[model samples]
Target: MKACIITIGNEILKGRTVNTNAAHIGKFLTSRGYEVERGITVKDNLDEIKWAIDESFGKYDIIVTSGGLGPTFDDMTVEGVSRALGLELVEDRETLEILSKRYKELSAELTPERLKLAYIPAGSHAIRNPVGAAPGIWISGGKSSILVLPGVPREMEAILDQADSLINKNDRFYYEATERLAGVMESAMAPIVNRIMEEHAGEVYVKTHPLKSETRNPEIDVEVSAYADSAEMAEQAVRDTIREILAEARRMGKK
Candidate 1:
């Protein structure tokens, strides 16, 4: 399965806010066996968000978007998604009730701005946000699923935790193992990684990351990962690849 992450915020484009949501969503999906194929940053413009959604729907199995889900005027993620999917924006009564009760508890009036959070695309499920008021949106189409989350890192993570069943719809298993090598240059590890990848072919993938300057005390971290139909299979594939990598490093006279 493949996933695409769309971060909608002008703040992100202006470099005012780091897009930690995309990183978190990417890692979350990858651990569940979905390949994160793309990460897109779009301004709060409706057209850009719609375009990102349209482009990702058919190409990716899962589309996770963050930002613009608040009650403020700039929060238009729901509307953009509605337009892109051609779904009518309808008010979810349960969500409205929840919001109303929440505001009443705070001794605050439910203004139009606060009421706006209750509207979502027709036929979409609202995933409760554990840390915020705006509920996350979940839409399941033929082969794709869209998960709209709040931009706030804490709220996004909390909503995702509640959305485990929706996100883990597939049975594929993914496993990764990493080994740190001291005094081994990434330059030398590159060929070894390539060879291991070729030898394992579709079963495993190997990559090397240099931790220190190659000219000085060269240290590299080699990561081997695999995806399979079962957990045992994926784990065994990564284990085998890691063993091969260590053997190759020893042959090259690197500890």
Candidate 2:
């Protein structure tokens, strides 16, 4: 299954906060064997969110959205989701009561605006919240399912962990991964990685994320992930690829 993640917030774009939700969710989904195709982060605008959702319908089997589920005016994730699906937002009394109880348990007051968290798009299934006020929404249609999770890191993590099995049970894939090599630049290593990928022909992904240091030279993460039928085959392919990459690195200055 193919999955895409959408992180919503202008803060992310403005660099006020790093958007870690995409990476977190992508890694989780990929570990379960799902093919995480793209992870996109967008501002809190309705048009952009709706456009992203609409465009992703035919391309992915699952779409996960995080952020913009707060009480403030700028928090319009639910509204954008409604617009994207051509649905209307209606208050869910049960959800509201649940939110109220949550606030009460925290020794806080639930204001009218806070109650708006219960107003979800019509025909959407509620994903129970154990750590936050805004409950996630689960909707399936057009050969895809979308999950709207709270933007709060802790809350999203809780939901993803507690509800992992039930979220998308049947959608899993196998990925073989191996990483090696230290001081190599991605641009310089791109041609070799590309050639190796072309030679393999199966679903493979090669990426390099460099780590910088002031006291020492930078080290690159030469990671290769591939998909196959069995764990053994995947492991062997990755091992062989790593050996080849290591040989090439040894020939160069990177050790």
Each prediction's Cα lDDT score? 0.91, 0.79
**Model 2 regions more than 4 Å off:** 103-110, 167-172, 182-192, 208-220, 247-255
Which 10 consecutive residues of model 1 have the lowest summed lDDT? 191-200
Whole-model alpha-carbon lDDT for candidate 1: 0.91
Could you give candidate 1's per-residue lDDT for residues 49-158 as a string of tens digits?
99999898889989999999988878999999999999999998989999999999999999999999999899998988777899999998766789999999999999
Candidate 2 per-residue lDDT over residues 1-255, each given as its tens digit: 788999999889899988888889988887767788888888888888888888887788788999988898888889998898888998888888898778898898888788888898888877777876788888866667888898999999887786576555543446556564566666667787888888876756667666755226656777877666666666677778888777777777667
Candidate number of the best lDDT? 1
lDDT of 2: 0.79
Q: What's the true lDDT of residue 65 in model 2?
A: 92
Residue pairs of candidate 1 with colliding backbone atoms: none
Question: What lDDT score goes with residue 200 in model 1?
Answer: 81
